[model samples]
Target: MVAPLSAWPWENLGNFKYLLCGPLAVKVFHSWNYEGTIEDHWCLHVLLICALRGLIHQLWSSYGNMLFLTRNRRIIQQGIDFKQIDGEWNWDNFIILQALLASMACLIFPSLNSLPLWNTKGFITLLLLHVAVSEPSYYWFHRFLHESNLFNHYHSLHHSSPVPHPFTAVHATFLEHLVLCIVIGIPMAGSITMGYGSTSMIYGYFAIFDFLRCLGHSNVEVVPHELFNKLPFLRYLLYTPTYHSLHHTQMGTNFCLFMPLFDAMGGTLNSNSWQMHKKISSDSGKNGRVPDFVFLAHVVDITSAMHVPFVFRSFSSVPFSTRIFILPLWPFTFLFMLVMWAWSKAFLLTFYNLRGYLHQTWVIPRFGFQYFLPFAMEGINKRIEDAILRADRIGVKVISLAALNKNEALNGGGTLFVEKHPNLKVRVVHGNTLTAAVILNEIPKDVEEVFLTGATSKLGRAIALHLCRRRVRVLMLTLSTERFQKIQREAPMDCQNYLVQVTKYQAAQNCKTWIVGKWITPRQQNWAPSGTHFHQFVVPPILAFRRDCTYGDLAAMRLPDDVEGLGSCEYTMERGVVHACHAGGVVHQLEGWTHHEVGAIDVDRIDLVWEAAMKHGLRPVSSG
Candidate 1:
């Protein structure tokens, strides 16, 4: 009834194909059109259905199948051929099996996704469960396979690539993949099935699972550790590139696939993950050790060790002038430093000498600011003098004040008076007492400028205050420590806005003696008061002075070989009695002089006497 089978549209076409083809084509043609219209449509629909099915089968077999084919080159090559068939039950097959099971659970219990227990709870609890169940099971099994006895047969293929690429994720033994999949799948399926809920939630959960699984296998370096780790919940969810790459390089460690928390807690986590991040952050190009604060500390320690000996050796050679001037070119700061160092050096030298025992046992003790004091004072004095000279050159009135004793004056009566000049003036002041009242009464009101010399008495302090109150600029020159201390104490509060103080010390060994006068000693002097030979100890000057006197009077004074015929001289003839000598005395006449004066003898023949004394082992007496 369907119109002769050969005459119908489908039948005509089939008969024509059968007539022109071989027996196999004939068989296919006959099998293709065996029924009527309803049957034909059904047959056509089935053929169409089979064609669609073939397309999907090709995609799965070719594309999807390559993921598993990663294990062996021959297998992958064989997989490309449509006709060639090879079967191997690899780990990837097992994972697929487990994934199918999980997919089935989702399909069967779609409502599990909407269940309040699964949908409403915090993400942390879910993440914890994911890690607690999956990582330990995988880690223990992985470790078992890596044992010496089993590794060759069961684990060698997995590590063949050394650094597993994305494709390599699926390359494993059948049993191994099966075990991993089941371990991961059972918990996931159970969680979803037991917590069944709405369809939308179920779909959402699967979507998320698929997305994450694909991301885990991807090779992109997109995520940052700070973003991943800092999040309280997501830290367990995301696996950064550092995390997965470490797993590939360091087998058996970093076993958790989805979460890092499990590996960290189980002590199986590779520290290389975090370390790599740190290295990258530091911009270290190679796998070199990271340079941290601790590294810097080590460098400092080594540097200090290498240079310490040299630093100590050269310390004494540095001059006081260099120390003082170079250390503090900083403004106003050097003032406090200069004062402190001078005070300390003076104290140390005094204490050492007074103890009466020294053989240059040690170098001088240096303190903060102490090193710079001598030179700083020089620089400050120079700057002050330069200012004064410039003012003098510009025709500004320059005033000078000197304190004098009333009895020594050339005039018959004593009086505080000022000396006048075309552009400068000098003043001599005599105080009845070292009190503020005498100073106030004696200082002239007309004097807009003043200079105080020999200002080592209480009278100097009084005079300083009186001049300060009168709005006069004052410069104080003194040698007394007590007076220096007093002026320093009061000058800050007193109205003396422009007060300058200067003091000086006599050098003791090849050193300058400024301030009052130079104490010249004959070169024959042997020992210092401390019992140390004169050549053994070095004493730096602790004082300040004007530019002219600093170099000319103090620094330039050379020691002479003899005191005889030089000028009027006082000496101790013996340790017991003092004697006087003048330029008229012959060098040979001073035989009775004490060992101290004997040591001071300037005669060229004195060496013979010293040699004789040494032969007799006579101790020098009253060394000055």
Candidate 2:
């Protein structure tokens, strides 16, 4: 019963490693021994393969059923009355049928198992024939299952979860899996028999295919888009996450398991699948949303790119005389357009301010006349002062003027002069000393003080002269280091005794007592005094006087007081303790006083100060 050594491929121990590890390993493993045979090796391999398949099928099916049960329980507890169980089936009946078929194939046909067909040229032909028919055949039939009615009946059960987990792959009904396998397997089996095939090649092919199919179904995002897109030719040779994820969303598209070429050609490829892929990738931190600036830049770039035609069309549309007229006037036209646009923006801002302050709503249409002529009426100053006083009662201490540069009456320093202070019964005079004198002469005798900010400048100094002549106690607060030095140089020595440099923060703390005046410098340095003793009054814009005096003359001058208990008798004393405690600079406290004491404070003014502080990079509380 001893067969020749040639009959057994592994009898040669010298080639053992080659036989086990080489391409022929599958062939050697599947070879059957006819003489004194210990059963055909092919039967052992088939049994092992079927057992592994059954084990995987059982595990996945059990897990999927558990998931279904949990979801059903949640639905019932939520008071939902209806539920659908679409893919439930009898697994035992399907297993019995499969067992019977396998028994008939293996036990009844022993001759089929004994073929020498595995070693011959027939094996090569059979392998090629099987792969060629199996791949396309499976693709087409799978596509048919995705048709509307068919998907609802069978395929939708598989797509119930948009994000398919590992268990979902084998979670379909037994009948569905069986139908798919038979549809694919029948063509493959027929090709093998028709080509005089061996069982080893067929088994090897199935093992590789199934392993890849398992990988495709696994919830792993390993493959990259660039590589996937690059392999246009071999793209059909494998299944990707993109392909499977799309199948879960738009169930009808991308029906093939291994090949995508069929789906692409059939016009069933989901257009939005790539967007979903990008979203998933971004959610996983692989990509991110586009920045707003970059998006805006792209829009601008596109618009600019399209503007060339419009420019060319404009040149072609005009007559010769019209073209000549336009060519010379276009620059001025552009300038005029710019001016108008600027005016429009200012008008809108002023309208927004009036609407916000008066109506507590931004109803621009209701205040059309005010917007068109911002400072047209004469009594607006009185009304504004009344409004400011009402606002001060509510603890608001700033007023904003939404004056555009184009408004003639409100332009430059005139804007400040138009603001009325009811508490002082005076109108503010802005500009250098000359304009201040003119405004001062116009003020009624009842006005007591003229608060002058920006007094460090030549204009502010001149205004101070006029206020002094009028016997007004002119308080000038300043932030400018150079201007402060200049004011010391230019100011009459006797006039210096009346000047007080206090910060806004100190002013607020001492709001119970003293009134603050206009700031002469920038707001960086603190100058206001704090405590409960003094009632504060802010300088009204205009100061009235009964008589005029020279710049060097003392107009109703008073000597400085020498209080023994006070820390410093000198008016210009620099105390670190006072400076550190006062946060609001001299300018803000002075401006706050004008609005606070004059009763000109409004919500709009407070909002403006808040916004301005923020714009200048100050950390103020947001009001709106």
Candidate 2: how many backbone clashes? 32
Model 2: CA > 4 A from native: 1-43, 54-100, 115-132, 272-624
- Poorly placed runs, candidate 1 (over 4 Å): 1-96, 99-128, 192-217, 228-237, 280-624
> What are the per-residue Cα lDDT tens digits for candidate 1 across 325-419?
33343443345334533533211000001011110010111222322355544332333233333333433222111111122222111221122
lDDT of each: 0.34, 0.37
TM-score of 1: 0.28
Shift of residue 469 alpha carbon in model 2, Å: 83
**Candidate 2 per-residue lDDT over residues 1-624, each given as its tens digit:** 432221223323532423232322243344543344435554454555555554454433333223112221111111100011112212222333343354456566565566554645555665455456665666677777677876666666666543343334554544466675574466446654665556655555555555455445544433454554576566555566556766765676777766666677678777765555444434443222211100000001111211111122122112112333245545654464345334332111100011112101000111213433545433333333343343343333333321221123433333433443335322222212212222333334554554444554434455555445445555555666566555555546666544444333433332222222232222311232222111111111122121221111101111112101111111111211111001122113323335221111221233344333234332311101
**lDDT at position 241, candidate 1:** 48
Lowest lDDT block of 10, candidate 1: 290-299
lDDT of 1 at 50: 32
483, model 1: CA deviation in Å?
99
